[model samples]
Target: MTAVRVAVIGCGSIAKHRHLIEYDLQPGVEITAVCDIVEERAKAAAEKYGATAYTDYETLLKEEEVDAVSVCLPNYLHAPVSIAALEAGCHVLCEKPMATSREEAQQMIDAANKNEKKLMIAHNQRFVPSHQKARELIEQGEIGKIYSFRTAFGHGGPEGWSVDGKDSWFFQKEKAFIGAMGDLGVHKADLMRYLLGEEFTEVAGFVESSAKEGSDVDDNAVCILKSASGVVGTLAASWAYSAKEDNSTVIYGEKATLRLEDDPNFSLVAQYVSGEVVKYELGGIQTNDAGGQTTSKVIHHFITSITENTTPPIDGEDGKKSLEVILNALESAETKRICG
Candidate 1:
């Protein structure tokens, strides 16, 4: 097969660090175009990757003959931009929290279905090495019946990572819709779903904006999720961990407790009730810190799905289910009641 021509929309940190870099690394993938509302950022990325630059995504979609595009735009633009690309006959690899609302997420899925295009959500947590291994172990029944779990994705904040620093749209409720929950919480929500192979049926959460000054969206959130099979867990997302980033999950089962991304030396570890222990030295997760450009595998998977004419693992339906968990958490926060 010929190379899969690709464009990356929104040359922000995620696009610059993940999408463009990963696409350039993939074989049979060509970086054909780059788009950003900011012309300079778009030009810089396009020049670095030897691709055409456009300030408007619509124009890029109309002019460039691309097989796929990564929607790395802000939270608010995800749905519209993705739907536009799908309608324009391009497979889409959209950044997480696929849309601000469930209705918009459904519309994105509908557009993909109508156009017969692949629509994958960039929930990169599922692609992490230790995460993949843990899923395999669970599926193999290495850990008997999952009983409870606690997962967290927290860091100082996106101000240090986003292109705009403290002034990034991530702090704005209108642009971000929800702050830490949308940015960090959704990843854990999606990760738990993948690792456990179960849908979260109910959620109760306390989401707040206490951590970040002058921010309208939640900067700290704690949610309790009940899975379909009655497994319950705590999901915590925050921008207040000022010292070090914490992306960790511990799954308790009848046989053992599987810990992921928690230990410094081992990325994953399982301790049996019978006093046996197993440790995995899988590589580190991608972080906002310097020199943390671990490959997420999202772009490569998106390209392969397009070229192979196969459905993406984290397709629109999968993305919507994850988004639903966050949305229900938000509703639960506002109403002081459990939501689903």
Candidate 2:
């Protein structure tokens, strides 16, 4: 397809800061349309990207003849918008926490399949350099027999980065589903699966909304995950990290333990039982910092997938697997019992 014609739905912070910007910069992609409920935001983005703007997504989906779309809307709207786009014959790149529940996620995959369209989820952690290096090391047997692990993603709060600040839809339970778990926890879920190359079989968790004030949704969440291979680990997601952000992952194995983003200088390190050590200088994980190194090669992959007529790296099935982990964690927290 010529330039992989694309449209971006939602002119929010992520749309403005990363998605659109990256699309504009990507070599084989073109920003064809921009849509948002807020007309002003849509107009602003349209002006910036030289793309037509629409206030309603329905009109945009019906009118615009784009090859693909980036569904950057809120959590609740993900499945619906993506389904519509897929049915409209457009490949979709939807943001993370694929949907509010497993059923919704399944419907999305079915829609994509029925329409013969591609669906990619924006799970950016898998594209991180350090995380990629660690995965390679583990796969190469640098970390012999993995036993357990701990991964966490936390920051001050979405209030600082969200388009609506403290009043963002993220604080609204109906709109966000489960705040930190959806926003941050799901990333770790996907990452752990990618790094360990296994699916989580069971999960137990504690989710809380005690961090930020005036928010009804959870700000803190921690889950214990057991993989199909009996590899257990702790995954944490939080908005109460006021001092600094902590997005770290560590894997313990018999031969050597691989640490990712654990030190000040070395972003990835492996320590062996034979007193051997390997330090890597790959960049650390991107946090909520606006000026930080945030964007990834995800856009390039998306465009390439569309042009080459291949399934994206982070496809709908992959997204659903990660979403299941987070959704199960929420259920485990509510029932105070282990969930599968």
Candidate 3:
């Protein structure tokens, strides 16, 4: 089988830790090129991964042998880069929080359609073993009717994790567009949508910058989401959690309640109405970078989708839906009213 020649558009943390390394592990995928605004970073990644390096994404896209591109840039750059990659005749696996706005997200969907290329969003949380188990129980009706949920993804500020520390683009609204909401909130939003298999109909939220100093964007956010199926839930995201929680979701149902906790591993606990609680101790779903393992699974799904001509697990529309939830949360915070 000819390997899928993949190019990575950004050499940032996510790209380095997840995409590049995961693709390297896939036997049928080859890292063909690496791109970053900083030449040295791109060159270093390319050298490490044994791929060509380029400073300009457009130049990297011009590589005739490239079959797919991973849009691993900052949140604001996702749509433009993915659209360009689709137009350039390569499939796209874009990092989450698809775009800063719904309109931009739609444009990406349109571009994917117009180019006849597959576009997948990297909503990796859905691929976690615990998350998948929860989804199975929910789908099998083992939990009975899911009436509500609570989900969150929190961590210490990006200062330490990012390559540039406090100078990282994550602290800048111009580059990141939003802080904790875009960074961690989007994951919970997407994960709930995936597990419940429902669309969010409306939202109300409160966002604040309580922890990180010298930042204009919100460092913490909490939102109420009402799904189309009449399920209601709360989602909380923060960069202020010193304990570093990655992502966790709890589902309440008529027959039972399910809890997922993130830390040493992804474990599931279910409490039935009979007053019996069952704990499932799931092993190492956490990758080197906390969520990187799931990210790898998401990439594998994208590759499978491309090869099989089937929809990716997290397609463009799936990606857009998650972004809409986050955007609505932001609007709700601003207007002090529910937003849809």
**Which candidate ranks first by lDDT, i.e. highest?**
1
lDDT of 2 at 211: 88
- Residue-level lDDT of model 2, residues 122-216, one tens digit each, is 99999999999988988898778899999999998888998899789999988988799999999999999999999999999999999878788
How high is the CA lDDT of each candidate model?
A: 0.93, 0.91, 0.87
lDDT of 1 by residue, 263-282 (tens): 99999999999999999999
Choose 1 or 2, whichever is better by lDDT.
Answer: 1
lDDT of 1 at 303: 82
What ranges in model 1 sit over 4 Å off?
A: none
Kindly give the stretch of ten consecutive residues in candidate 1 with the minimal lDDT sum: 285-294
Alpha-carbon shift of residue 131 in model 2 (angstroms):
0.9
Q: Each model's TM-score?
A: 0.99, 0.98, 0.95
In candidate 2, the residue pairs with backbone N, CA or C atoms under 3 Å apart (3 or more residues apart, or in different chains) clash, namely: none
TM-score of structure candidate 1:
0.99
